[model samples]
Target: MGVLSNLKPTESELEILQILWEKGDCTVRDVHEILGKNKDAGYTTTLKLMQIMHEKGLVTRDTSSKTHIYKALINQQKTEQQLVTKMIDNVFNGSAARLVMQALGNHTASKEEIDSIKKYLDELGNK
Candidate 1:
């Protein structure tokens, strides 16, 4: 757990973080454009959400130039782990096996993905 271990991003904030994590660093316009493709979002709403995220320590804004650049301060992997851990605890009664079983039962795992999962399980078994 790092500084952001306890910080849980809201759905809207997570959307912005996804853009930042994928694009590295971006201006509000950059994120807004990409977000516009998926949902009906207003520019000011995105800007305001990003500003709040900065205050929450989820992102950092550099105001050196005319347009401010924003970068994700939270680690993507850590955030995913945190969310998944919470899900396992709350939704699956702390049973990771149940979660995995439900996921595999409901969704299709590609052959490659199955192979990777098998490999990971093998590694875990070794440990």
Candidate 2:
């Protein structure tokens, strides 16, 4: 378990959180603008979700002005690591090979991505 354990966002909340993660610090309007692209997300919806996310400690709010800006409190990499570890444990039956294969099967990787994976494996072998 990590610092954000037992604290995960719903799909809608994850959408807002993803915006904040990308923007670093943004107003509710900024988040709304991004999420509104794919769906019908009202400004107030983004605003309310951010307030709830702040309460959940998933985001840090700067209350310097009337429009408080929000940013993610946790590092993306750490969260991904924890989530992947949990997936490997539960869904993969504790097999890293099965997990990696399942993930790779789902996407078309670029040449750069393939090279990066090979390089990473080479480094791991060195250790």
Candidate 3:
């Protein structure tokens, strides 16, 4: 709902952004190593994906040092909001109530989580 409302990075780019967000700034090697821990991506693949992300302005690189450090240019919350908005529009036919119903029905909600959601809804009503 903020800036970059139309920006939607690919799944791989999002994965890299997650790493950058968690690790702050990282080199290709650092990303590759972390990615390799879960999947079978080659170092070159990681490097090429990062290069594309940089070109797309999804990330920024500092080349002052020998190894370039890449950081996510987009904020995580903004990106998440953009993605969720798109999902609601496309998958729920712009029906937020339908989306919320499907989510709550499909997943098990703990009492604490349900209470939290109720509190948030109450706050929205106050607003």
The candidate scoring highest on lDDT is: 1
- Whole-model lDDT per candidate: 0.93, 0.82, 0.92
TM-score-based ranking: 1, 2, 3
Residue pairs with backbone atoms closer than 3 Å in model 3 (clashes): none
The candidate, 2 or 3, that scores higher on lDDT is 3
Writing each residue's lDDT as its tens digit, candidate 2 over 9-123 gives 6778777767777778898888888888899967877778888888888889899899878888877778777777887998999999998888789999899998999999899
Model 3 lDDT on a 0 to 1 scale: 0.92
TM-score of each: 0.93, 0.89, 0.86
**Candidate 2: residue pairs that collide:** none
Q: Which portions of model 2 show Cα errors greater than 4 Å?
A: none
Model 2, residue 40: C-alpha shift (Å): 2.5
RMSD after CA superposition, every candidate: 1.3, 1.5, 2.0
Q: After superposition, how far is residue 16 of candidate 3 from its true place, in Å?
A: 1.0
Model 3 weakest lDDT span, ten residues long: 1-10
